[model samples]
Target: MLNYRNALRVGTASCLEETSVDVSYEDGSPDDDDVPRRAIVAVLPPDQETRILMLTTYLNLARCASHVGRNKDAVVCATLAAGIAQHDEHTDHLITAKILRSRAHLAQNHLKQALRDSAAATELAPSDHKSVQLLARDVERAKRAALRANKQLAKEVSTWVQSAQSKFAEQGGNEADCAQQ
Candidate 1:
């Protein structure tokens, strides 16, 4: 079993090399090809370390996707990372995944979802991690800004509707007539 695991790791490494894909967290230039990394993670044994590694890979993929302006793919990868972390009861990975997912949501303008994920991350993160705390705070500010924008939009729409209604009334058209049309 140990030999098989080693062989699998070696094979995955070779495949990654062949694909020239770097799914490292610190890698500024990530490869566009994520299939090899995904395949390796899919075949990893259901062990604690392997699970953590898989979550890490997913997180990296999410980051890469976001960097490439693929917000939808980033959200998908982050969601996968979060799910795996939750299933494996890996608190650190869970926090990391939540943070990543929150950022993805923010990028996609999913303010509510971003707020929720950021709140979860803040709750799960340790007090020592000041960076995560700051991220959570930033997310909170973004959520507020989104809420304000929505409110402003609603007010604008209401005003426009009222103006249209007044114009229709001037043209001898009632609400019922407008509804029928």
Candidate 2:
């Protein structure tokens, strides 16, 4: 018979494994169903160790969400993980959460928020840590990419709106009414 602590760990790990397998089978696109919700519930045990495990699970879920273009969900999971890590005084998890959140923000074209999160992650990480340095570099790159993408998106949207207004005006419609429509 497993001890209570060990059982909790095993259960949490099992839940993580199940979710990862399910995510892999979906080719990086998470289902808009109950799998992630169930995983979150499964990992929420009351013990400290289990709480740490829950933090890990949340981080993993955030990564999965980011992978599948669910940037909003990724931000929510990463923020929850960061909050839990802060409450538990887990610096490593906190740093990971910040990094993940930064990436999610970048994916969502929130460049400023991504840069802020990257700065927080750098401040939280030890100066001598090589891995954290790499993470910071990656975040910087993502920020730059997001800036360029945002500029292009803005230009495209401007062109689209102009075209729409011209077409509406040619059809005897007012530009203001076309915008509302």
Candidate 3:
């Protein structure tokens, strides 16, 4: 039986295994952010190099899965991306993680969940950018759509309740007893 940390270590190792062959020098540096893809991939330990590639690869693959209506696959990819990104705890990585999670929910047909996450990401970002604002507005639209859907569901439920009440009344048509009912 492995502990939680060791289990995660194993998971991260599996993710990094793919990139190990290419990254000849693994220094386990936290300050590797200057090297673009290399930097992101190098954040993990030497043994976990493949896991980094797996994480990034899944992030890219999630979008394609969404297009093909493979929602379960999309969700799996996006979730992996978010989890890996969040592991780093860097601000940019957190933003990426939030977006990945949001997109995964969206792909799974959970627009409300996506909107909530997008809103959270917008608030989490420090600066005002056009893309951030756009995401925020998209979240608003998702909220409206979810509200409308809820209202429709409520109406249907109300109708069913009324129908059931009428049926009960018709069956128990005795004056005093029915009135009490």
Candidate 4:
């Protein structure tokens, strides 16, 4: 399994390193700032000589995957990149990886996990860094999404409760009896 996973990572990194593609957001809205305008590929030489190069490759692959809506793959790649960066104590790369994973989680509507990652990224970056600014935007977006989801869930539950109450009332059951049931 380790060998297969490594092979997959190396293969994907090779392709991403060799490729340069324009990236647009999944939605037409302008607020899609999670991904770069162009895929961040091949910042280092293709030699893949150092840990930083590997980290870049993984980050680029994850970004491309997220751009293309392969969010699950993006999450895996970003998590791997985050692990590498954390191990190497590379704050910038770790921040990028966390933001990418947060984006993937947001895309999948895992709002709680998304919020956690975005917050973590925000905390990791220096206050004046561009990454922190970007993370601020993402954290706001995630909060809004969570709020909307919570409102929707409350509405649904309220509707269900109302329907149940109406049915019980029609069947001549009092609120107290229904509560006991």
> Could you give me the TM-score of model 4 versus the true structure?
0.64
lDDT of 4 by residue, 1-181 (tens): 0112132111122222233323332223232122321334223233435767778888999999999999998988887687667656789899999989998988898877787888898889888878667766876877887789889999999999989988998999988888899
For all candidates, what are the clash counts?
0, 0, 9, 0
Backbone clashes in model 1:
0
Instruction: Report the lDDT tens digits of candidate 2 across residue range 50-149.
Output: 8888889999999999999999899878877886786678999989998889888877767788888888988999898675687678777876776798
- Residue 80 of model 4, lDDT score: 69
User: Evaluated with lDDT, which candidate comes out highest?
Assistant: 2
Worst 10 residues of 4 by lDDT: 1-10
Q: Put down candidate 1 lDDT per residue, 1-181, tens digits, no spaces.
A: 0012222121223235664443322123232334344334334355788877878899999989989999888877877777677666788887887888788888888888888888888888888788588778788788788789989999999999889888998999998887677
Candidate 1 segments exceeding 4 Å error: 1-44, 172-181
| Overall lDDT per candidate, in order of appearance | 0.70, 0.71, 0.57, 0.69
Better of 2 and 4 by TM-score: 4
Residues 1-181, model 3: lDDT tens digits: 0012122111222234333312222223222112222223223434456656766787778768777777767765665565556554445654665666676676566887787768767877876756567666766776787799999999999898678777777896544554575
Q: Which residue pairs come into collision in candidate 3?
A: 15-50, 15-51, 16-48, 16-49, 16-50, 16-51, 17-50, 17-51, 18-50
Deviating ranges (above 4 Å) for candidate 2:
1-46, 142-181
Better TM-score candidate (1, 2): 1
- Against the hidden reference, what TM-scores do the models get? 0.63, 0.53, 0.56, 0.64
lDDT minimum window of 10 residues, candidate 3: 1-10
